[model samples]
Target chain A: MSSHSTRRGVASVMTSSTYRPASAAEARFLAEYDASAYATPLVTVDPVIVTLRDEQLAVLLVKREEHPFLGSWGLPGGFIDIRNDADPEACAVRKLKEKAAFVSPYLEQVKTVGGRERDPRGWSLTVLFFALIAEDDVPPIDKRLAKWFPLSALPDAMAFDHRALIDCAIRRIRAKAEYTALPAHLLPQRFTLSKMQRVFELVLQRRLTAGAFRRRIEPLVEPIADCFETASHRPAQVYRLRPDSGSLIFEQPLKGARRK
Target chain B: MSSHSTRRGVASVMTSSTYRPASAAEARFLAEYDASAYATPLVTVDPVIVTLRDEQLAVLLVKREEHPFLGSWGLPGGFIDIRNDADPEACAVRKLKEKAAFVSPYLEQVKTVGGRERDPRGWSLTVLFFALIAEDDVPPIDKRLAKWFPLSALPDAMAFDHRALIDCAIRRIRAKAEYTALPAHLLPQRFTLSKMQRVFELVLQRRLTAGAFRRRIEPLVEPIADCFETASHRPAQVYRLRPDSGSLIFEQPLKGARRK
Candidate 1:
C-alpha cells in the first residue's frame, strides 16, 4: 500500500488574487495558483512564563473563563494576530502583555507542538516560547484568573498539553544553563555570584559547590565594583554579564565526579 | 487606543459538531463553541535536507511545478495532512518522501517561521526542520526538478522565504556543532576521526587542529577495532557515536589561536 493513498488531503482555501507581490514574476505566479489546493491549520503562540520564587522555579498560568476548558488552568496564550504582528515572537509578546500584563526581557522560541489529537476542535499548531523574568518585577495581577504556581505544587489538571509544554521549557532551561548564562534572564541586573549559583541550583535541582561554580562563571561575568549588602551579613561583590559575552559557550558546569 | 482594537481577530472555522471528545464534560464544551470566533493561518512544515558533498555543505531543493513560484527552486514542503498524520515530524517525513524520495536518519525540529508576508497565498506558518543524511545514501532522483546545490552557489530566486530558512538552518547547525555530536548525521554509519573533523570544518568553515579536535570528540565517540586503509597511508582508527551519547554537550571545539 502506498503512503500517499493512505494520507488524507488538506484542502486549501487561500485566494491568490488578494495578494499583491512586489515583482511581476511573483504576481504572475500567484495569479495562476489553485487557491483552494490545501487546508491551513490554526497556529497559536503559547509562552511558558517562568521565574525563580522561594528558591524554586515557578510557572504562570491563567484560568479559562469560557468553555472548551472552562475553569481549567493553562498557559497564557492566544491566536496569533497575523495582520498586525510581523512574526511569532511579536505575537507571543502581545499575548504576554494582554494576558499577564508583564513584559519579559528574555523570550526565546523553544519548540512547536502540533498533533491531530492535541486539540478538540481541529488541527492546531502552537509555537512554544520560553520566557524568563525577574521575580521582583512580576506585575500586579488585576485579573483574578492568573497566578504563579510553584513547579513542585502544580494544579491537578491543566487545560491542554500544558504540563508537557512546561516540562519541555524546563528541560531547555536546564540544558542551556550548562553552557550559556541563561539564569541571568531570571535574576536582577546586578547580582552576587552566590545569588546566581542559587538560581542554577533551583533550575537544575542539584546543589553545586561554590568554588566549582565560581570557576565556571568567572569568565562569563565581570565585577561591577558595587557591593550588595545582605541583611545581617557583610557586603558581597556583585557581577554583571560581560559586554563581550556572546552566548558564551563553556564546558558543562556540573560534571561527573572528577579529581578534587 | 487599545491594542486589542487594532489587532485583527482570528476566525475559527472548526466545526464543533464534528469533534467527539472522550470525556462527557469536554464533549459538552466542544459542542458549545462558536467555530467562527477566530481566524486560523495556514501552517506548513518545511524541512532543510542537508548533506556533505565535496567537503562542502549541500542543500536539496525542488523546482516548484505549480503556481505560487512555478519553476523556481524551494525547500521541499507541503501543507500538513492534519487528518492522517499523527504529528508535524510525520508530515515532514511524508513531504520529504513525496518530493525527494529521501529518508533521513537524523531529523530535528529547528524553528517555526510565521508572519503575514511569508506566504503570497495569505498569512501562513511554517515549522522548519533540519534533516541530515549520508551523501552516498541519497535516493536516485525520479523527479527532474530536484537537485542538490552547494550552499555557496544557491539559485538567484527561491520560492517563499526559503533563502532565509536556509540561512537559519546553517546558523543552527554551526551553533549546535560547537556543543553536540550533530555532524555525525551527515556521515556514514562508521567513519574515521579525520573524516569527521573535515565535516566539522565544512560546516563551521574553519580549520581545527587534530589534537584539539580529538580531545573535544573523545567522550562523544567510541573506537571500533576495524580500520580502513587510506590511499597513501596506514589504516586509521574508526569511531561511532557512543551508545550512551544523548545530545552530548561539550566545550567549544576551537579557541582564539591556541598554541600555534
Candidate 2:
C-alpha cells in the first residue's frame, strides 16, 4: 500500500481535497458556529505502537488500501465499535491485535487529534493510544498487510493524515522517554546498563556519555541478581525496573544535557 | 444531552426503547472484526486549557449540548480547519479563540487519541492540545456556554468521552508541573515563591513543605528585579522563567528524583 520511497516524502505533497478553501464569510461563520446547530461528537483511536529492534526505536505501520491518498503507510488503527466496547482503550487494544497480531506491554491515552480537514472524509475526531513493546517480542508479521518502520525512517507515502500523526508521536515518545518508565518496555524483562543506554540513545537520536547516562537512570534501576555476557570487553550487569518507581522515569533534562 | 448521572448508569436502567442492546453474536462479531474495514481517515483536535484562579488550578470547560451525554462538562475544543491554518498549533489556537474567546499562553500537542468508539457519531479521530494560561489573564467569556472548573474539583458528568480525555490531560499537566516550567503558566508573568509553590501544590494535588518546595524549584527560578508586597509578613521575592532554559527544564530533576 505504501510507495517505494518513505511516507514523510509523500505526506509533504498530499493536499486534503475535502477541505474547501474558507472564504471570509465561512471563516466568520465557523468562528460563530451556532452551538445549537451541530453537536454530533465523533470518536476514533490512533495507536503509537513503539518497538525497539536492532537497537533502534520503531513504530508499527500499515499500508493503506483505500483512496484519499491510498497506498500509504500509517499507524494501524480504526474507529471504535461504540455498540460493543465501553471505553476507547478496549477498542484500541482490539484494533492492535487485529491489525498487527501484537499486544502492548504498556498502553496509555496519548492525546486527541481533531482537525476539520485532517480527514478528507468528514469531521473525524481521534483518540491516540501510546503502546510500548519489546522489539524481539513483536509477534509474527501479518504479511497479509502491516509492517514496522524505524522512527528515524518511515515509508515515503502515508495515507490520510498519518504522516503528521507519526511525526507528533515520535516527538512525544522521545520527550516521554526522558521522564517516564516507558523506556523499560523497550528492553527485555532483564537487561544490562549498556543495553538500556542503547534504547535511550535510539529514542533520543543522540549518544550520551556512559557516566552521565548511568547517573540519570541509576535511581530507576534495581540490579538483578544475574549478569548478561555481551561481546563487549566486560560482562554487563543486569537490572530490572525498580518496583516502587512510577511510570515515567525522566523529564526533559536541562538544555545542555539534551544537546546532541 | 447529559443527565445528572453517569452514562453507564443511565444506559443500564434506560428502557430498550431509549437504548437498544445488540445481540451477543453481533457484539462478538464487532469485537473480532478486522478494524481496517472502516478506516476513513479524519483529523480532529482536543484542547487541554488550564488556568489558575482563586488559588486553584482549573481548566476551561463547556457543557455538551447534544445527546450521547448532553449537558455534561468537557474541555472546549473542535475540528481544526486545515484550509485556514497549515500548522496544528495554529488550528488549536483558532479553536480556543472561536469557542472560548481566549488565547493560550502555552500551547503544545500533548498526544493524539484515536479509538473507534471514542465517538458515537462515526469514525472520527482527535489530536489533543494542551495549554496553560494564568487564570487572571482569561478573557471575558463572550460565549456564555463555556465555564472554567478547578482541576481538583472536576464536574461529575462530562460530555462525550471527555472525562477520560480530561483525566489524561490532568495527569500530564500534574506530572509536567513537578519537574518543568509548566507551573509558571499558572502564575503571573512575575510572581513570588509562595505563589509559585501554590501553583505546584494545586497541580500536583500534594502538599510540599515550604522548605522542600523552594529547594526543588530554586534552580528553575531566577530572582527578578521586583518583589510583591503583601499586607502581612515580609515582602516576597518574585521570579521569572529563565528565557534560555527552553521547553525541557523538568527532565533532569524528575530523572534524578526517585519516588519513595
Candidate 3:
C-alpha cells in the first residue's frame, strides 16, 4: 500500500487516484475543525413500494404515528439510522423491512426533495426511492399500519410532498416502459407474453399492438421449453426475461395505438 | 378557506389535500418533540458546471482552501445555507455563483451521493447536479481559484467520489442527447447546424451521419431569416432552437455513421 492509503479522506472510494498525505498545517486545521459546528440538515430516506393491487398500479403507504401529521398517510420511510445504516439506499432498505416487512425488492432512486419548510422540525431533505414487488409476491400485512393505494385514487390527506413524489415515480416508470423491459419486474418470474404485455399496458396506462410489442420484446425474453410443452396445448406461450433484459434499451419507443 | 388552512405541516406544500388540524393530544407530543434530538447527517449540494473549453467538453473544478483534501480540485459546490436556500437546486445555483461567478446556467439534479465513510468528519450526504453553460457565453474567471479540465484528461489528484459523480453526469447528458434536443444548450442561443453537430460529437465522442442528423434536428430548430441577408448567398444556414425544443424528444436515437 502507498503512504497515503493509510490516510482516510475524500478520494478513498474512487479508483485511479494518487492521494497525498496532509501537511502539518493541514493537520492543525483538522484538529480545530468541528463536524458539528454547523447545523446539519435533517436527512431521511423514503421508499415508495409499488405493486399491482387488484390489477391497478398502487403504492404502499404507512399510517403516520408522529406529531407532524398524526394519522396521516405517508410513504414508508423516516430518518436514516446513522448508527446502522451506511447510506441513503441502505436506510431505504431498512425502512422497507421495518415499516412494511418487505424484503429484497427491486429498488431504484427516483428523485431527491429538500427544503427548509418541507418538514416542520427544520430544514430537511429526503431521497425518494421507488421499489417494485411482483403483484403475487406481496406479503401479508396489517391494514391498520400500512396499505396499498392506486396511483389514481390516493387518500384525501397525505404527509409531506408525497403526492408529488409518487407522481414523479409513476412518470419515470411510464417513460422507461416505452423502451425498456422495466414492467417485467411487476410480474411472476415465468409468465405468458400476454401477461407481460398487460403489465406494460397497466403501468403505461395505454393499449399496445401485439405485433409492435412482440417486435420490441423478442430480444429481451426467451421461451421456456418446459412451459412450451404445456403452453403448446394452450394458447399463450410462456417466457422468462433474458439475463441481461433488466438493463436492455431499445433505440425506439413502443409506439402507442392511434386515437380512436 | 378551510379550518385547517392555517396549519403548517407536512401537507403544506403539496396541492389538493384535505388537511385536518392536529388533535389536542398531538399538540402535546409536538411540544416535547425535540428537533435536534437526533444527530442529523451532514448535507451538501454540488453543481458540476460543464462547458466547451478550447473545443473540448470540460467541467469546472475549484481549488479547496480548507483542511480535508486541502488545495485539491473539486466541483464548484458547497453546503446549503439553510437560512437562504429554499431547496437543493437553489443551493446548487448559489454555489455556482459563489464559487465560479456563474449565474443561472441550465442546472439539473443528476444524482445523490451519501455514506458514513465518504467524508472523514461523519456520516454525510450530497446531492449532485450538472449545469450547462454555452461555450460563447462562458464568463472570465481567476485561474487560481478555479480551472476547467477536459473530460478525457482530468487532473491526477482530486477530491471525494468526484470521478464517479462526473462520470454519472456525463452519462446522463449522453443518454439524453440520443433522443432529445439537449445538445442545443451547449451552444449559444443561435448557431449554425455544423456547430451544433460538432457540439454533439464532442459530447458523445462519436461521428453522426450528416443526412440523419439534419432529419432529426430540423423540427427542433428554425432557420433565421435575418441571417439570410448574407446566408442566402452562402451555402450553410444559421438557426435558433424552437420555443419548446428544450423538452422535445424524438421517437428514436440519432443514428451514428456505420463503421467502415
TM-score of chain B of each: 0.85, 0.74, 0.87
Best by lDDT: 3
The single-chain TM-score for chain B of candidate 2 is 0.74
lDDT of 3: 0.75
Tens-place lDDT digits, model 2, residues A137-217: 777878767888876688776665677887777787777766665677788778888888878777777777777777767
lDDT string, candidate 3, A1-260, tens digits:
10111112422232112333378775565455444445556678888888987889999999887667877899988887666677888888878677777674868988889876576656678999887789778888667678889988899878877888888888888887876778888988988888888888999888998888888888989998766425456766679888977577875778877779
Which tens-of-lDDT digit does each residue in A1-260 have in candidate 1?
A: 10111112221233333455756876776656432344445577889989888888899898876556667889888677644566788888877777777665567999999874566665678899988888876777646758999999999988777889999998998888777778778888788898888887787777778887888788888988756647537778888888777776665545422435
C-alpha lDDT of residue A27 in model 1: 75
Give the candidate number with the greatest TM-score.
Answer: 3
- Answer with 1 or 3, whichever has the higher lDDT: 3
Candidate 3: clashing residue pairs, number = 0
In candidate 3, stretches whose alpha carbon ends up further than 4 angstroms from where it belongs are A1-21, A142-144, A226-234, B1-21, B226-234
- Output the worst ten-in-a-row residue range by lDDT, candidate 3 chain A: A1-10
CA displacement after TM-score superposition, residue B36 of candidate 1 (Å): 6.6
Interface DockQ of candidate 3: 0.27
User: In candidate 2 chain B, where is summed lDDT lowest over 10 consecutive residues?
Assistant: B12-21
| DockQ per candidate, 2 decimals | 0.31, 0.10, 0.27
